[model samples]
Target: MTSEPAQHPFLKMANVNVALGDRNVLHDINLTIQTGEHVAILGANGCGKSTLIRTMTCELYPAIPGLDQPRPEVSLFGHSRWDLTELRKHFGVVSDSHPGLYSTSRAPDTAGSSTGRTTGLNAVIAGFFSASTLWPNLIVTDEMRQRATEALERIHASHLINHLVGEMSAGEKRRILIARALAHRPQQLLLDEPSNALDLAAQRDLRESLRGLIADGVGLILVTHHLNDIPPEIERVILMQKGRIVADGPREQLLTAPVLSDLLGTEVRIGEQDGWLHSW
Candidate 1:
């Protein structure tokens, strides 16, 4: 009897190429994450890590191969075709660039002190609508509210339900965003530079919150330049340089001083303290 073909991973891309305007942002990329696997993509700025995540989520499309060439493939949940709305329901994405956290007219330094914005619970509720805030025309059902409330509780954030996002601490606000993503009950969580603006203590809190999610069986995809941002639970690492992946392997193999130094184009000393990775 013939053997059946191997099952496609939950997310997979092979020979993927992406261009933004005239610049080639990603080249010959291949990534595969089986269901329930947690991975990190590490690189310096402009290394195309963000582009790769965007492409994976369908925000950016991979370039089609030339005539007679094998087609570049990107599949989610084992399927090549997707309805954008349905596709998004499978993954929760959080990014520093996410709106609603900062007002367009507000100064950057005033991020956590700005006023008249969505509250923490409301922000999580907005996830149901796929919006930064609930649009006036959209009708919210009672079930949506319950889900949002439960999401906040999952992260121990139910107390912030009534607090304005701009008035909360940076760490608290980030947890609220995580709650927003969890409200959707997605299979995986994608975080892009999650600890970008938090202080050291806040970073610790964020890590703790992420550990809780991992304990709850949520898959994580962490993309960041900061080594500390990679929670210890994520075992696989993909190192990128320029616009290509230079290494992909278990965390222990790829996070050594020499490998990290080469990946970031600078001297990097990596240390582990209390099961967390730190680089300097």
Candidate 2:
């Protein structure tokens, strides 16, 4: 009998370099994340964490190979190129900086004129079309609606289904955005600075939701500067500085005060409670 074919990693990069505008954002990067792995990319601001995520999602491309240099390798699920729409089916992305996600427009007469018209449910449904909000021209089937509702329930945000996106609080909006990403049931989720604007209670709630996803076997790739944002379920940590990864190892090995202090460019203190790491 033939052995089963080897599985490709969810994401892989080798000798990768990325540049944006006048600056090089990622340099000679080599990374791999297998299926079902929960990993965190941690770093200070402008360390290229977001740029790396973009590269993985195909929003950015690696630098062209020089005349005499071997080509850089950047692939998702073992494919070097992809149709973006099809790629979204495999990877769901949530980022605060994703444009038009919460764009505001004039609301109807019943709601405040300044509020956004997109309701939480509609926003989630837009995931099927890869659009920020449902457009009149786009077709949304009943099955898609059902999936969106289930996604909200999974994230524990069903109460916000009818709430206008602009009317909900920051935490509530985040849950909706996560649900939007989950609507299609992607194999993995990519979150960029997910807790950026959440309050303490909201942060706790978000962590609980993330833990639920982990328990359900959905993989996560979290990119954040805050140590607290690294969920307990994430076993691996990759620390980045100045556009390069400085350390890649188990969470326990890389989250020490010394490692963090060097990564963050300051003296650091750390503590752990319930498998979550916090720093000051």
Candidate 3:
């Protein structure tokens, strides 16, 4: 009899702890995520969701194990360490608060900074270097430009190609940032509060874009505090509280009013419309 191939996990963490400055932000985090899985990491502000994302991206390292303690295990694609430049090829990261998304260049004589003035297409191409903007020293080949154009098309932001990122609306800028992340054609995307500071119309548009990505088989690891940010395609939900994961389960089970009320430390009411959940 033939046997099935073993499944390889995209990410795994056991007994992981992270500290920022003097505070230990993540504690005893045990998580396993398979390739192509759609999952949401839900939490309130200050719950360490951002820290966890950083750790996954290798921007932050876990606390070293004590001599008497078992070593903490954290791996991505079964590897414990990665080169950031190469890592961007496999996993794209987008955060609403990323300064690069709003970065701008100033005149050589100017004393103050401004919003990012790079055009959308150039910004996407910069993804290859994991840079905020294309620098004079960077070499962008024809293939890179083509890939950047394709990424914009995939996100339905081709119209934004020539638009300056600083001049685009919040929604437009968000789309450009997403295109930047997609430029490398990564297998999965890690998003942090992607819908933050967006209006009603923009939020709807962002969700539609996300759905399209999911349809194209790009796995998503979405971290957000807003219930509405959880796309319908996401079936698994992991809840974090006080720097720890408190619950991890199917969305239908963990998104109930009582569960959310406890998680948010308030009396919460929820409603569903067209597979999207809203909280009150």
Candidate 4:
């Protein structure tokens, strides 16, 4: 986890607009995720928070115009996304949409032969492979495996290495998903609602994990609807209302009653737990 970008403008957005069918989902949108910033995209359901996340990462919502989503030419590091394949070694994405179907088993077909025996740790391990799990030559070094073990240990998922996904609790699966994300060793973590299904204790663990991440200087952009999900290290908030960013500034400036209450469209009380911001 590195601190700031080696250069300026790691991710830039300009005049971005997206629509779902005839309904306009995103207005003329513009935003940027800085090198050292950890921003949380907050909004009510159907307020286009999820839509914005998909669009920013070049993913299309169901029943959209074409089969594939259209992504603007993004300049990551210094090269365009087209020519930046190798350069993309610096990026990682974590989403709830990932199915447990894909795996890290060197013999995916072998696992396919028998259904229901893969653990969450196994799924997390699968994230290490660049391609599908069916590749004949699957190789992971001892150190990398050790790192994976350490990552799971960080989240208390090490004990679940042998427990199949079907047997593990929801929180366990979520932790594994996060562990998989860390396997990418991302400098900037894009979390698509990391706390969505977590319980209070699990959420606390995630908060601590995020604290550790920022402590090491990794940038993060977490998409969440609740104020509590906003990690303490996050200095800024980008409130999204009706697909466009309504407010963007420091947490102290934007997380106030006037700003957040307006964005949420209801009266809510905000409280701070440790360094995190919470709404009630």
The best candidate in terms of TM-score: 2
Cα RMSD to the true fold for all candidates: 4.4, 3.7, 4.3, 5.6
Worst 10-residue lDDT window, candidate 2: 101-110
Better of 1 and 4 by TM-score: 1
Per-residue lDDT of 26 in model 2: 94
Q: Where is the poorest 10-residue window by lDDT in model 1? A: 100-109
Candidate 4 residue 245 Cα shift, in angstroms, is 0.8
lDDT of 4 by residue, 103-202 (tens): 2223333333322355555566556664432234667667657666776876666887776765555577676666766665666767777777778887
Q: For candidate 2, write residues 1-280 as lDDT tens digits.
A: 1221125688889999899987788989999998778999999999999889778877789988689876799877777887777766677888855543322222331344423667889878876776656888999899999999999999999998898876788899789878978887878888899898899999999999999999999989999989998888899999999999989999989989998888888999998898888888
List ranges where model 4 is wrong by over 4 Å: 1-5, 60-74, 82-88, 98-116, 130-144, 154-156
lDDT of 1 by residue, 1-280 (tens): 1221124467888988899998889999888898667999999999998888778777788887789767898888788777656654667778765443221112342444333367777777877766666668878899889999998998888889998776778788788778878887777888888897799898887888889888998888999999888888999999999899989999999989999887777899988998888988
lDDT comparison, 1 vs 3, better candidate: 3
Candidate-wise lDDT, in order: 0.79, 0.82, 0.82, 0.64
Answer with 3 or 4, whichever has the higher TM-score: 3
Candidate 4 global TM-score: 0.79
User: Model 1, stretches more than 4 Å misplaced?
Assistant: 1-8, 98-115
The residue pairs in collision within model 2 are none
Instruction: Look at candidate 4 and give me any clashing residue pairs.
Output: none
